[model samples]
Target: MTVSSGSPLAPKVVRGAFVRLDEIGIGVVPQVIAFQYNPETLTRKLKPYEQPADKQGTPQDPAARAAPYDPEEEMDVAIAFDAMDDLAEPDRHPQTVISGVADRISALEMLMYPPATPSLLTSAVGALAGALGIGGGADPVPTTTEVPIVLFVWGPGRIVPVKITTFSVEEQAFNSALYPIRAKVTVGIRVLTADYFTSKLTEKGARLTAAESIAATAYRAAVEQKKVLAAVGVASTVESVLATLPF
Candidate 1:
């Protein structure tokens, strides 16, 4: 969550790459949900209450008290990265490693699991994307080799930070399931680029833009598939089934 730059090059634009990925994933899922539930229904379902009366029986304005935390109605998503130390001498560029890992993770998400609900998927993607860039001019291009690790979660659930103990390429293949139930899906990617190549590519800006575009596209595709599955489930509810039953 925190990025420190002791030197100019050390703090590359790529630092925001993971953050953008997270935002894109988080942000998109919500729109899918809203399309299904609609804003009016969501507001009616989650309307805040006025303050309750005090123990003394005096009517206390609801606004006076802190708002209650409703886990069922909230969405939580996060993005993070750890220092890359597992790469061999020839594969040490952090930016490339991270980008590659991110792409792989996005591909897995697009191809594998289905989301529990369209709303949940939309919220997760929307938040993920927003965490990248929304209120700005052109999106910032990443410069560093920092690999982005993204976690997308839905529902009113507890947020737990994932701790990285060791860095191993083989371990990365199965890292998605390491987190407990709170996170619906977890992704960990490693970027590795040779120092010379990274330096050469960083000078052009196009490479970083391409990587971002690809990551975003992959993320959107994955979430869209999740949304489709959710919609199918909703359409096939118990009521619908009973109505179709030949009694």
Candidate 2:
């Protein structure tokens, strides 16, 4: 399904009917936190090690060559992982959660028209965008603005991929210890799905649900470190915006 760009919430809209595919929790190990490496840092450190010019066109001084090079300083980044035990009791079933939300959204879309077209997907996205406070103000919306929405589609045989884009606002906050703009805010919708595999007696491979296909597609995109980081950054930005919004 496709969503329109005109809706206020279109920036954050995630639309689709999803069925439970599979749900399994995997343990996440603690790892060192590394910031995006700055190329300049490496260049600056290496510059000091360059060989001195030979004015006499002869062998350089032994003392100059024997000078010990200073080691490059490493930035210690702080990173912490949440304990799995701290998660909700009974554990939230990822597949069930995705399926329930997708079904609700699909039912809501059905009520919007006598005969639903793919454009209705835009309305569904707009509904979500509005709730998230994206667009829908007196100001004219920018045509070029784009928001990233992730969708997971599951089908009986294969998975389908769809990505929706729209516009959203951006906000920033100060950090006393670091820099003035330490945090940011962005409003958008994030769609996630979990798929289960089912084996058929007649076929050698397993059959997948419609929802599972979509979820698989989203999962593939999310597997990329850059995509995952971007998704998380947007989510964190939206959370900050929500916390400051006046009720």
Candidate 3:
């Protein structure tokens, strides 16, 4: 997801999706109003690993050094929607109001369960058939599988796979039947850290999804690294030297 100089300069439209192990598709696509995220870092000032030298043969400006740090990146998104409240065709999809809300909740619930697999049902049917003396072979027992992680893509320069950490739903209105018609949902997601990719989620080609998150992470790292380098005068020094070079 590198941004090339030739790429478009406009802000990319934000879109989100869920990536599954057995299937490649999104569970729900919400119209998000605002998306917020920040990288939180913890740094400890400790004795310098290698002290700088001066003409006096003593450590120069040696007191404490900030350790190399990686910030924890997390995102919070807000989505507001009104289902049956449309003016043009208020009844267009009367069922949509509640149905849409249901879909959103369903998508969140999926994070806690494994993707729908036929093996579980197949095994049960096979067992029943064998018990009934019908001609059938034993089906292989199914192992537990993990639910898919969601990917939020704001175009190529911003594609990150994330896990839903927390979410809240607030209903503003409801129909006569008490079904929600207007609601705002706030979802908090943590970017799947590189450590996670290298660990548990690596099985079954999940590495591809890990790569996507890594790319998003690289973008943040570049920004933070740039700031650090600029503060240390490295960036300006390099730029000045490069400017004097002949083509």
Candidate 4:
């Protein structure tokens, strides 16, 4: 999206956002949690997967190739929210006057929780039966709680699904109703790789359920896009390097 500036020569400004999908692949794009103001700084770390030290010397199979795995990637960013700006324009942001930044904060936090399921009442009933010494007539249906897939969008080049590993919120001010008026939030996220859907994810012994399988498919699609992007730069990069050579 392009924003009109006083000078036509001004660069385009597109805000970053965290878009929540209905499920994963083929799911509807339902909700968007946009950044009010982009974070000034982002912290990122990558640790490539390598053979263990003990296994390095023990490898004798010449035909076996190196194992492929995605690097462990971590990202941290601080988001600031204030309700004063919205409160100044009450007509457009009437909800802000009532809840301050509470609504926005809730939206971000909800990404970590699974969507409500219809089995909630059934589960409650089973618990009550157990307490009264009455057995449930039949095996209860299992309920799965899967967090919604989220795409962290920083322009078009970097759009990836990530899992929230850490979250911290600091409320600097609150209104009379105890709603936070000004707050700062810090979130630590890890990118989910495509291998996850194929049972190739190597971090833990964890296995994906049917719901997460959908995300794996979408993750693969994103990985393919990244590959194409990298390939496009190869020729130009090689030419630039050759032109700068001393010989």
Reference-based TM-score of each model: 0.22, 0.17, 0.48, 0.69
lDDT for each of the candidates?
Answer: 0.34, 0.32, 0.51, 0.74
Name the lDDT of candidate 3: 0.51
Put down candidate 3 lDDT per residue, 17-79, tens digits, no spaces: 334322222112222222222123222222324445878887756565643433456766665
For lDDT, the strongest prediction is: 4
1-247 per-residue lDDT for model 2 (tens digits): 3335568876732222222221111111111111111112211112223355588767565455443442221121111112122223325544322232232223322221232222343445555556666645222221322221223232222122223222222223222332222211111222322322122323765575343444555454544544567788989799788899998
If ranked by TM-score, best first, what sequence of candidates would result? Answer: 4, 3, 1, 2
Worst 10 residues of 3 by lDDT: 24-33
Q: Candidate 1 clash total?
A: 47
Cα RMSD (Å) between model 3 and the true structure?
A: 11.5
The predictions' CA RMSDs to the true structure, in order, are 20.7, 25.4, 11.5, 8.0
State the lDDT at 37 in candidate 3. 22
Residues forming the 10-long window of minimal summed lDDT in candidate 4: 21-30
Name the lDDT of candidate 4. Answer: 0.74
Ranking by lDDT: 4, 3, 1, 2
Residue clash pairs of candidate 3: none
Candidate 1, residues 1-247, lDDT tens digits: the string is 2234557667522121222222233221111100111111111112344666789999886456565532122221223223233224326655434442443334334322233233344454455556766534232232333333332222212111111222222323322334111112232332221221234455755353333444434444544665788898987896878889999
| Residue 174 shift from truth in candidate 1, angstroms | 21
lDDT of 4 by residue, 1-247 (tens): 3344448888767777777765322224347888877899999898776665455567454454565888877899799999988888989987888899999999999889876652454556556656665554332334348777777777766677788999999999998899999999998999887665566455487676444565676667767787998888886698888999999
Question: Between 2 and 4, whose lDDT is larger?
Answer: 4
